[model samples]
Target: MTLQLLNRATALWRAFIVLALLAGTSIEAVTQDNRPLLVAARKKRTQTKKSRATPPKKKEKAPEKAPEKPLEEKAVDLTELDQHGTNTSESYNRLHATQPSSTPNFRTYFDLAFSYRPGDQPVSFENFHSAFLLEYTPMAGLTFMVGLAPPTVLPLYYELDWQITDRLSLRLGRIWIPFDQINPHNTFGGFINTSLLRAASQEAFLPDVWADLGAAAKYDIIRDNDLQVESHVYVVNGFGQGGTDPKGESSSYPDFSLPVARQDNNDDKSIGLRVHGLYRNTVGLGLSFFTGGYNNQGTTNARITMLGADFQAYIAALTFRAGYAYMAVDLPLGTSRQFYTRGGLYTELTLRATDKWKLGILGGVQQNDNNVSDQNDRTIWGGKIEYLINHMMIVSLQYFKDLRQAPGKTNFDVALLRYSLTL
Candidate 1:
């Protein structure tokens, strides 16, 4: 019975060991699964605590945009005027430094006049001349200008003008003495108007381009009213009878009274006066007076006085230009006993038939009180028409008749065709 009890106890011990092993294995499996679960739970709790401790990041606001500008409208000014002061430069670059020369600004003109005279004529071609003008503005209110007509390369004038104020300007060097509108190679009327030929009386007593080494001052009234006023005063070396022109040629007979004086024979100089005005933007009037000693030969001394009046007005397509010049010479013919009076008159009218076509009529008379030469008391009348082929080309035809009526006079009935080109 005791042996039986021991075997039974061993069997029971073995069952107990298997049962304990199974319980241990089951516990290990449950611990392995529960270990992963507990670790995952602890990690989730740690993340939750970390999230609670951190603060939220703030958002950045974008910047606002600027407002847009309005579009500008372009325009054209009719009376293109800069009311700025004279000394103030018109260009910004000129004010800073010298003007840079790009393509230079220049003007050149060519004119050819072919004339046909019915009677005996010395030459076939009446006139051949070329004119050129070049101007450069180096800085503000400064100008250097040169004008030339060829056959003689000598410049017509080399003038320098300085603008001191808006209404005042000073000129030095050689300059055209301002007298009548035509004397300076300057035109009195619009394009397609005024005769291409100058009046005989106009050319009788002055150089076509009457320029001399002189000093001049010009003053403008700068008035608000349309009644504009300008005054010119100049002192020059004056002219000598039978002197030479800029072309270095002797003066012709009829042109003896009008000569350019390069050297003065006496200490006395010439004084010129001009008063010009305009009204209603259409009517213009001018008064001119010039006095100078004509000769200083000691035996023959003469004082010349020139009084001139000019008027121009435009009514629609019709334009009228008239001038009267009375020149008086107090000549000591024979030891202060006698003097001669010479005068001249000319008038012109033009009608614009079309925008590019012009028709004109002109009349002129010259009186020589001495009555010694056949050219004394001459009358001239003419008609002219010009068609502007283009802005740069013009074709003009003029017909004129000379009335001398003297016994040995050689009158002329002439026709002229002219081609004028401006570049």
Candidate 2:
């Protein structure tokens, strides 16, 4: 009976195992039939879960607003009057011309100088000055200038300037010839020494070609922050057959004429060249050259050639200046008989003590084979003190000793005091 029971149990277990295997085969077959669909559903569910897990994207920011308009230009006061002689009615005209202005402007400039001399020649107070300078500018590159002074009651200088380019210009009419820095009317100082500058440079072997009917060409060879070079060339009516200007007394080699004659005295016209340079504007140098003809009582073929050099330098409160000139002048006795190289040299030092005061020392010599009629020699030593009363006015006291060694004249001394104003 036990054997029969054990066999029955074994059969029951075998039957159970077979049933489980059949169920497994049926499930596997179903899965194989829907394989593609199951995979797609699983992937779709995974994508939906990922989408729900992430945060939302932010919106884009707006752009900023633009500005309304550009700013307006500043207005100028046209009705304002200037008390300082430096700025006259014409100052505006000059300023306007440098800009783009539609209308022309007119202005006036005034300058005055007075001198007092005491000696056996008698004490005298004389006003030697440049006053009533009128200027007009119609365009950016063009200007017309006219000036009037005493004695002649005529326009001292009248010129038309046309700036052809930034570095070139053309000038016409009576213009100032730049031979020396000392007497160019630049108004560098108040007191002008009659001995040092007048007899040395002003009435030098070369005549003061202050104003002459001519045309000039100017160019800036170099212009920059640290260095600059400028040049000028002029062609004009040269000297005449030097006779007394009806006022009597003519003092020149063959007489470099101060031609008031409207026409040329001879066929030859004079030519002049000047080159100036500046290093940082604290130091300066200039070279001058002139070649021309002179006639004596219509006796043609007389000529004059001149060369000059000048230098200036500034160090702290002190300024130094120097100049030298050599001229080959012809004094026609007959034919091309002879010529002489005569010259002048000068040196000056100035100390600026304060805003209102200045002190200076100057020395010079002029040696000529013939100044008046024979060889002339001169030595000058001078000192000056100046006080600035205002921006437009200055007062100066200067003392000088002029030692002369001439053919037949005794040595003399000259002292002068000057009061000057610029308007």
Candidate 1, residue 317: Cα displacement in angstroms equals: 1.4
Instruction: Write one digit per residue (lDDT tens) for candidate 2, span 1-423.
Output: 999999999999999999999999999999999999999999999988987898766877888788787653332221111100111112223333454533444333333333333322345565555446666666778877776654456675677777899998888888656565634221112223222234322333444225677888888999999998888898877666544322123333454426344456676778998888889979888888888886644564767788888888889999888777777866555423366666777777888797778888877777555434322456767787877776656677777665655544333455656666655
Per the 3 Å backbone cut-off, how many clashing residue pairs does candidate 1 have? Answer: 0
C-alpha TM-score for every candidate: 0.66, 0.66
The lDDT of each candidate is 0.60, 0.60
Worst 10 residues of 1 by lDDT: 78-87
lDDT of 1 by residue, 88-110 (tens): 11121112224454323466666
RMSD of 1: 16.2
Pairs that clash in candidate 1 = none
Task: Give the TM-score comparing model 2 with the true structure, all chains together.
Answer: 0.66
